[model samples]
Target: MLYSIWRYRHFILASIRGDLKGRFARSRLGAFWFILHPLAQSLIFSIVLAEVMRTRMPNIDSQAAYPIYLLSGMAAWGLFSEILTRSIGIFIEQASAMKKIAFPRLCLPVIVWGSALINHVLLLLAIAVIFLFFGHYPGFAWLYLIPGMLLISIMAFGIGVFLGILNVFARDVAQFMTVFLQLWFWFTPIVYLKSVVPEKFQFLIGLNPMTPLVGLYQDALLFNQRPEWMNLWPAIVVGFVAVVVSFMVFRRASPELVDAL
Candidate 1:
């Protein structure tokens, strides 16, 4: 782990700059669009659902600021989903560089995930501004969100690296991930709350690694409450296990990645 981390530092640094520039190189708005995309989505969804459709999902409290609640959940979900989706093509997309330069294969996924996380942090800053304007103070409990965000990022990176390597061999992996992420998003609590789920279904929801993650963000940032540690601990354990397994899989497959490409 240490060796890979050390070897990949340059790739990480380069990828960050490359990814950022590649994303906005041709665009007039450049990096501003990164912040604008999420903010615009949050605003449009919040207004359309809360006003036009009046579509209030069952789990969240009726009196609660629904937009704030929804955006908090969406912020975490968006980062994970975006990273996983983009990481699917990392190796294939960077095949030229991979053949010419020997670098840690793991850095591919890390860079993709890191770029998306930077966008998420920007959105969180926007969320903080909105909260302040509304006279809602998140208090010290908001610190709990950092661990939750880290766990989500780790899980996303692990899964992304694993799938990324597989996608090198299987052209269908990216297509499958598209559908998988869509299903996973709805299965998660982004559009609904855990309390609204039926008792029997609640256990199943808890089994989802993303459940506790989204719950943690909403609890800490929106409700100004500490994360439910008992529930969160299981997700953290699962995330760590996922990371170890993914590392082994990616390492084992690294030798064949270029060949597969």
Candidate 2:
């Protein structure tokens, strides 16, 4: 798979560019739409929940703390969700092209991953600018975002490809995932602080693979503190297992994928 991807590297890059172009081809604002959703969400939450949650932020002293915290979590969650969402339907969406064209099937997920990564980087830049506007500046700890986001993307990509293959066989898988992701969002503590959750429910939050990853983003960007690396172990383990399983499933499923689509 790696060799095939490398051999078709140019095709993947072009496909990514084409996907981005087609996404905003009709919109005047173009790429701004990418950041607008999350930015608007951050603003709405800042207005509605800031005061209620501001005091809950233990060590953060800034009045903009909650907004910054929200954006950080949003940034992490948005990337993971976008990849998973797009990936789930990619094979079916490209069914016609897949039937007629001879490109590697693996290329589809790679394109989704690359395109989502570009959009995510833009969102991060927007959040960084917002941080400055709030009189907040990132320190050395901000570097944690690199590993943090990489881990997130890998995990999302793995699980997404796995689910994408399953969706090709069972159409209802797509619908179920849509509802599941919405619930998953609330469970991840993106809009609300984890510290605010009751202790009895804390273990439930911890069971979520995304909690530690999102917390890493909040710690690094919102609080300007180094993330607790040990916390990422579970996500790391899950990501590795997911990626390995995805490859195995994809290899076994590839023969039947086009027919199902």
Candidate 3:
């Protein structure tokens, strides 16, 4: 699979380029919309929830504390959601081409992954500028975003491919994922600080693999602190297992994928 994907590396890049062009062909703002949408979400959430959560936020002394924290979490969540959601639907969305074309089927997901990384890079750059405006700089800790994004992409792709194959057969998996992701987002402590959760409910948050990942992001962007590596082991273990298992399942199911679609 890896060799086949590499054999068609140009196809993947060209598909990504075409996708970007087609998506923005009708819009005036074009690529700027990618940065604007997430920034706007962070701004709106900060405005509406900042006062209520301000007292709860700790360790950060800046007036822009809530916005910084929200943006950090959003950045991580944005990439994860974009990759997972797009992956789940890609097989179905490209069913026609898959039927007619002779290209490596894995390229569909790779295209989505590539496009998502581009959007993520743009969002990070925009967030960096925002950090400058707020007089908060992550400095050396900014390097953490690299591993953080890679971890997120791996986990999202794994789970997405597992479900995307199922969705091909069941169809309902797509509908179910829509609600699941929304609930997943709220449960991950993106909008509210984890410190604010009740002690009893804190255990629930701890059960979520994303909790620590988001905290890793918050530590880097909001506090300019190194992540508590001890806390990340569970997510790392889970992500690794998910990727392995999902690939195994995809390999077994690939022969039937075209028929299902």
Candidate 4:
């Protein structure tokens, strides 16, 4: 698969480039628009909930803490959700190309990852600039974002490919994820601080694989502290498992894909 991907690298890169430019091509914001949704969300959440949860939120002792904290969590969540949501429909959207062209089908997922990675990096810088706006500059701990984002991307890519393949059979899978991701977003503690959640309810949040990952982002970017790797390995394992499952599903689906489509 890797060799196949490498063989078709030019096509994948071109597709990704087209995807980026074609998005918001007429708009002034263009790619900056990628940062708007999360940035707006962070502002609103901070304005409404910041004071209410001020004393309770863990890192809210500073004036800029809540926004930074919220943005960091959103950054992690956005990357995963963007890939998963877009991936679920990749096959459907690319049906014409897949049927008419002779390119590697796996290139679609590669394009999604390439686009999402660029989006996340842009969002990260946007978040950092916003932090400066609030008079806080993130420290060296921000370097942790590289590994942290990569881990989350693995999980997102795996799930995206799995769902993208599944959606080729049942269109409803795409519809279901629209609702599911909303619930997933709320479950992720992007707005409310995890420290504020009660002990009994912590287990529910823990069940969410993204919880620790989001916490790790907050710890690194917002708190300027190192993440505890002991807690992160479980999510990493889940990511690996998802990748394995994705490959299995891809192998199974590729054989009948044309007929199914």
Ranking by lDDT: 2, 3, 4, 1
lDDT of 4 by residue, 1-261 (tens): 778999999888898889999997899989889999888988888899887766776535687777777888988999999999998899888888888988778789889999999999998888888789888888999888888989999999999999999999999999999999999898888788777788998888888889889988989987788898888987899999999999898987897776788
The C-alpha TM-scores of every prediction are 0.89, 0.98, 0.96, 0.96
Q: How many clashes show up in model 1?
A: 0
How accurate locally is residue 18 in candidate 2, as Cα lDDT from 0 to 100? Answer: 99
Tens-digit lDDT track of model 2 for 1-261: 889999999999999999999999989999999999999988998899999998898876889888988999999999999999999999999999999999789999999999999999999888888888888987888798999889999999999999999999998989999999999999999899887899999999999989999999989987778888898999999999999999999999998998887
lDDT of 3 by residue, 81-188 (tens): 999999999999999998999987778888998999999999899899989988887589989878888888888888888888888999999999999999999999
Output the lDDT of residue 189, model 1.
Answer: 81
* Candidate 3 lDDT: 0.89
CA lDDT of every candidate: 0.79, 0.92, 0.89, 0.87
In model 1, the runs with Cα more than 4 Å from the true position are: 51-64
Error of 4 at 244 (Å): 0.6
Query: Once superposed on the true structure, which residue ranges of model 2 sit more than 4 Å away at CA?
Result: none
Return the clash pairs for model 3, or none.
none
Write model 1 residue lDDT over 136-164, tens digit each, in one string.
Answer: 77688778878877888888877787788
* Candidate of highest TM-score: 2
Q: What TM-score number comes out for model 2?
A: 0.98
Clashes of 4: 0
List the candidate 4 regions with Cα displacement exceeding 4 Å. none
